[model samples]
Target: MKLKQFIAVAFTTLCLGAGTSRAQPVELTFANALSLPQVEPYQRAVDEFNAANPDIKVKMINTPWVEYWQQRRVDTASGKLPDVWLFVPGFGAEWLYGNKLLPLNKYTDADPTINLPDANQTMLKYMTLNGKLYGIGYDFNGQVVYYNPKLFDEAGVAYPKDGWTTDDLATAARTISKKLNGNGRKVWGFAGASAEWVFEGWFRGFNSRMITDDGKYGANNEGGAQTISFFMDMIKDGVMPIPDQKDPNAQAQSLFIGGTAAMALGVGHATYIFSDAGVDFGIARLPVGPAGQVGTGLGGAYVISADTRYPDAAYKFLAYITSGPVLAKVVTTGVPARTSAWGKLSDRMTEFAGKVQGFEPFNAVKGSFQVMDIQKRVLSEVWNGSKDVPAGLAQIATEADAALAKAAAK
Candidate 1:
């Protein structure tokens, strides 16, 4: 396809997948915020979808993450939003859902290929309100603890294992930081932000939550704070680094993948940083805390838009990108979302690392995650500095309760 024709089709279908209806030609626009330094894999999937569905055109709009929200807000406010788009479950999901910019409960057909073994109908219950499916898997990611094997050897500490607890992680950090590298310079043993979702994994590691089943915030929230406190104590004791802002890092990825930082509580998709850098990395389940191996967050869901001039066109494009071949391809890039393709994805990822030994650590702890509310309000405030976590969480709970109450009142 010529460049102009490709953009024409993609813009029309918003760059949907292959399973779309060829009989009906539809056009849509897909707005995405995945413009990381690397988007080749995403581009490949888009190209595949465009090739498969020539009639239903899908255009890919890339936005820098830093400025994406600003651009999206303008688009949404001006009613110029694309027909099909990529959205994080937080603000973006809430913005569309709240404004009625999305078509819900329409996409109920089971995508058998959307492989999440632990996922069932009940899990999809809230994804559809008043009986509608608002989203599908654009990309899926899982949370895990990542560490540098080289650091472990330096500390003379036993490396982390599948069933290791938070205390075990803290213990290791304490030991390693206490011992100086050749020149006695202290190296950080573990690090990550105090974000709610990040901490949620920690709390889940300890078996707790910031919210109750009826959409309430938990008592001892800031799972990351508690975890950080323990980690900071290690820092004070020479185990971790005091999270300073002067050059305060925003995330643990750069430090860990750069190999100076020893450990990080991060997502499965983070392997890209390491592989690209030729770093030696390893994974373990979220270190266990008091609750005996907890995990509580899952990411990714795909959805179409009401504004889309070409609705069915987008679905077709969506199918092509998320199905067999492309799905496998996504794995080679980073963490993949589908369960059916796990064998291929695992093999592909392992091979990408030149048959590295520790990639399966994530696969081992895959069973522990639970679905969080698909609400953006709470997630944003908690994860994205909408407010301080404890205060933000409390505020979020109150807001959610009010929203739920209003729904009940209706």
Candidate 2:
């Protein structure tokens, strides 16, 4: 499909250029999961950094998110790794952290510019192995609800507010679905990337979770059950489709861009894509559940690969990427990762400014922790499966116990 959005940022200032200084260049290799507009900004940042210190040169390597892992694993086995790398901390992180990634706590203590105290604790919580820090963050993403404004106006439903409940939003989504489409049109009221992330919002709204505090299967817990039942209710209400294509790989952004679905739970990186479509859209916090409001978090932080030849240089890259200058480029096109930079791009979401009818409900809901517990993969064997919903949840918990045990045994 044609790209629904072209990143609006200019590359002139953010492009790679010559290294400054009279010293020999110390080249560093940076690796990321995929090609994104951030690449240019990163490249630009490298140029600026290199200009200040002519001794350092940098080369960036790009790989698909899916394929990135396969390459990393192969590289790890052979002892060839990039200097600066971005990788998740749980399932994949543990592997590299165990064998290859350098412990970041060492530099965190020695580097004055690298403030371990100010570093987002949530990221540290995930990247730290037992008790030591081992990574730096490139971006921090905040998620919200993205909806079509034109559809809402035609549906004649009142626009959603920040404190709006799930039921209220679902009613509106369903109602809008019926009204906006001509008789027998195929438009869906709401759709998204996956049921997992949406359910993450649901559990948070209800002030609950799919796993226990100690990371046990609590999928059958009252709160977890409520979260699941709510989606099933949405399916019955025609606000959501039956669990047919819950593939973790399916994208929520595509659904909105293609206009196949009216609303979705979206993260910060999406605004660039959605806004590019020239369709009217806006964002708000995820809807409130019967219990409360909630949100989930994810990251693309910097980690010092154990295979990195220059640990100091990689650590320098980590700190540089999270600074204010780099963040300006990130938040404008993608989501903001730093507390200082959070909400910087809210004004640029043109659709929200023009229509005044999108994502208001999400804005009302309070934000919360986005944990990186290593349990989702085990749970997905059921959630992303064709098994009966309730039974699948029960089995998720059981399987979680088994997986944790297996991990512990090692």
* Candidate 2, superposed: residue stretches over 4 Å from native: 1-29, 34-41, 54-67, 74-82, 95-100, 103-125, 128-131, 174-188, 211-215, 243-262, 306-313, 327-333, 339-388, 399-410
**Full-model lDDT for every candidate:** 0.55, 0.59
lDDT (10s digit) by residue, model 1, range 1-410: 69999899887786465546455556677667664634677777777777776776677788887577687778767877777666554445445346544554343355554443423222233244455656555344445667788888977888888777778887887676666444855477777644334445455544455444443434345563464355546655655554433222345777776666788766555666566677787876665577656554444445566676666666666655555556566545454444444566553254332212122111111111122332234434443333454564455456645554453343
Most lDDT-accurate candidate: 2
Cα miss at 385, model 2 (Å)?
13
Candidate 1: 10-residue stretch with minimal lDDT? 360-369
Q: For candidate 2, give the lDDT of residue 298.
A: 49
Candidate 2's displacement at residue 282, Å, is 2.2
Instruction: Give the C-alpha miss distance for residue 98 in model 1, angstroms.
Output: 1.1
